[model samples]
Target: MSVRELVVLGSASAVPTRTRNHNGYLLRWDGRGLLFDPGEGTQRQMAHAGVSAHDVDWICVTHFHGDHCLGVPGVVQRIARDGVAHPVDAAFPASGTEYWRRLRHAAVFRDTDVIRERPITGAAARLDTGDAPFTLTARRLSHPVEAYGYRLEEPDGVTMLRGELAARGIQGPLVRRLQQEGRVVAPDGRTVTREECSVPRPGQKVAFVMDTGLCDAVHELAAEVDLLVIESTFLAEDSALASEYGHLTAAQAGRVAADCGVRRLVLTHISERYGAEDEPRFAEQAAAAYSGDIVLVQDLDRVDVPPRRRAR
Candidate 1:
């Protein structure tokens, strides 16, 4: 069976606390694992989360902040050290090429030559991961540095209705023929069409928004997503501080989720200032705006994506 979930490796914002590490998230979708904004100590966090370097198919960096990209060197070296057979794609701001290079080669190690570079330069761009069922798109975010957010969308498909097929006396080979050719002649010589039995299955969408203030791109990337993982760096009382540092407050994150029709809101990258006792306040603040599911992430937490929406 295929798995789709978000594994929180670390969820601290600017600094690491006793309970929270730096910003790191691993999204397991089907057979592909996409690691986002791996911060300091990400390798150790990955080990604790039971994720191996071989499982990573893509590394997406939101910006070159030390708290976000400091672990890139260790992760890259680990990939080479383990000699992962598959190619790992790395995506980040094209303007941060020098920073990416510095981290990628911070230490000398065996060159596995398996890492593929994919830099995002424009206001928006799309990447084609060969053989992957989904398309990845990046949009510029409102941050002090060149930052980008990513979204993944699976292609829409049709779901076969077994009951409809059985009622039409279409079975075995006839079912396969109907699916392949979109039509088949039933045992009664009646023409059966695939559309008559199957219903439209809408594609699933997941978005990752990190270290960005309120902006159009934020709303665009989050619109109508099945799962939205966003940074809620501060509470509503610290809105000034959050705006100054290009981060979103809990209320803002909630508003975005409500406005964008996000089915699930995952609040991560929390500041250490909010101690364990204050965690509930953040969820309460967000709940004031969004009625959907709210998840205040912690280190090593696993959140499964909601099931795909069925056609009515």
Candidate 2:
């Protein structure tokens, strides 16, 4: 069976607390692993989480913020060290190309051409993930520096009705033909259509919203997604500070989730001020708006993407 889960390597914000390291999340989708916002100490945190550099198929940087991307050099070096044969694609703000170049060669280490640079140029655009299972897109976010949010949308497919297939005496390769071609000829010289035997199954979607204030792009990226991993750098009580720093409050994250019809809201980029005792309050504040699942992520925690919704 395929595995789909978000591994939280580090969940702290600009500053690292005693427990929280920095912002790093590994989203494992089937055979691919997307590493997002590898902040300081992410190399160590990944080791602690039992994640190796070989597992990262893509590196997605929200911005050039130290807390969001300081560990790029280490992760890149490690990828080269491990001699990962697969090409690793990286996406970040086009404006930060210089910063990325510096980070890529931060130290004297063996470099490999396996790392491919894919910088975002427009305000909103589709990313080139190359024959991946899903379509990845990026949208500009409201932040002091150039930042972008990413969303992955899988194409919709049909869910074969087992009862209908059995009634039609379809099995084995015949079933595969029906699924692939949308129609198959039965042994009785009759035609079986996909619509007659299956329901439309909406494919799963996942979005990442990091280090941004409330914005239309935020909701647009998160619209109807199965999982939304967003930044909640402050509580509602500090809304002024949050607005000034271009970061979302827990309540804002919750409101976004509710407005976007998100299935699960995984809140990260938590401010260092909030300790273990205050972590529960993040969920409480988010619950004030969204009724769906909420997760105040902890270091090394793993949040599984919810199962696909029933076909309509």
Candidate 3:
């Protein structure tokens, strides 16, 4: 069975308290896995979340902040330790090439996986992995540094209609031939077009935004996404602090979701000040702003992507 879910490894913003770890998330989309913003202790956190280095197909870093990328060296070393033969593409801000290089060589082990440094330079650029089911798009976000958000879009599929199949008396070999050729002729002297029989199955989309203050780019990155994983580093009461630090409050993240028409909103990168008791208040604040499903993410929590919106 195929699966699409965000396995939250750690959700704390800057410093990790006893209750929370630093920022890290594992996106399991179909057969591929993408690791985003792996902060300290992510290697262990992955094990805690039932995620392995073998499962990671991509490592996407939004910026060079310690809380966003401190775990890269460890993760890279562990991937080598695990002996994963397949390549794992690493995407980050091209401006932070030095930081990524330091992390890439922090500690040396036998390099087994093909780790490619795919950097993002501007507002929008596509990362074509050549074999993955989805294509990645990186968009510039509003942060102090050259931060960017990542989006994944799967290829659209063609769904054939059963009624059209019977109407054309097309079966077995002819049906397969039509699917391959895009058109076929029936024995009854009728021509069947692929468009007449098949409907376009809209592709699934996931967006990841972190370490950015509330901005128009936030809405643009998350527009019409099936799942949006965003940072909510403060409560609504501390929104001022959030803005000063170039971060988002729970309410602000919710408001972006409400405005962008996102199907599911996941609130992460929490401040350590908030306890379990304090989470409800933030949730309530975000809920007030966002009508769609809201998730107050924690360490090891898994949030599933909602089904695609039916075609109008």
Candidate 4:
């Protein structure tokens, strides 16, 4: 049983309140675990979310703001403290090399885990992780400092066709041959092509856009994504303030998701001022603009990705 879900590690904007921590999100895709933002208190937040540093295979930072990257030290330290033998890749802005270096060694404990840093300096970069199931792509976003949004794409899967197999009376080796060679000669002198048996299906995509104002790049990054996790730091009423601070309000985030064909939209990095009373209403306001699924994230909430739509 493979699992794909987003574990809300922390969901607070700018400052940590008594009920919320700064920004942090853990995306669990099958065997891969990706940690994003990792603001202050992320280490403890992970524990509260029932995830361990051993489960993290990738670390992504959207920017260098304290509320976004301040937890890097603790997360790195915890990985070492747990003695995770596997190396974890860390991706962030190449321009923030100094900041990355500072936090990486902020208060080093015994270094047991290998933290490989792949800095992003251009519009896009592809990370080859040997034989991982998915590939990671980082793109530039509209932010004050150097910021990048990360996207994960899984390779396409093979579609089995029982109709073609039955029509050709093919089984065992001949079925395998048809799949590998795109055509197989049947005992009855009939030829079966792979196109007759298989259908093209695009790989699943997940995008993370944080700490950015509404921009074309944000829509570009999230277009056609199966799951889009973005920051909705304010409500619809504060759209102006959100724009002034380079943040997205609920309405803007919802409109972006609807326009981009996102299957599921997760709104996170909320301000502490929005309490329990405001959560449902915020989601409602966003829903009024977008027809797609909307999730108002809270600390330690687990959101499963909606099932993929199949060809009718």
Query: lDDT for each of the candidates?
Result: 0.94, 0.93, 0.88, 0.86
- Over 1-312, each residue of candidate 2 has an lDDT whose tens digit, in order, gives 898899999998999999888899999988899999999999999999999999999999999999999999999999999999998999999999999999989999888889999999788989888888888899999999999999988899989999999898888999999999989998887899988899999999999999988899999999999999999999889999999999999999999999999999999998988768888999999999999999988899999999999998
Enumerate residue pairs that collide in model 3. Answer: none
Q: Candidate 1: lDDT of 141?
A: 98
lDDT of 4 at 177: 88
The total of clashing pairs for model 1 equals 0
Q: Candidate 4, residues 10-34: lDDT per residue as tens digits? A: 8889988777789899989888899
Q: lDDT by residue for model 1 over 1-312, one digit each (tens)?
A: 899999999999889999999988999999999999999999999999999999899999999999899999999999998989999999999999999999999987887788999999899999868998799999999999989999999988788899999999999998888878999999999999999999988899999999999999999999999999999999999999999999999999999999999999999999989888899988899999999999998899999998989875
Q: Clashes per prediction?
A: 0, 0, 0, 0
- After superposing candidate 4, which stretches have Cα over 4 Å from the reference? 173-177, 187-189
- lDDT at 293 for candidate 1? 99
Tell me the lDDT of model 4 at 41. 92
> What lDDT tens digits, residue by residue, belong to model 3 across residues 240-266?
888888988888888888888888989
TM-score of each: 0.97, 0.98, 0.94, 0.94
State residue 219's C-alpha deviation in candidate 3, in Å: 1.6
Candidate 2 lDDT for residue 162: 94
Clashing residue pairs, candidate 4? none
Alpha carbon lDDT of residue 176, candidate 2? 92
Ranking by lDDT: 1, 2, 3, 4
Model 1: weakest 10-residue lDDT segment is 106-115
Candidate 3 ranges with C-alpha deviation above 4 Å: none
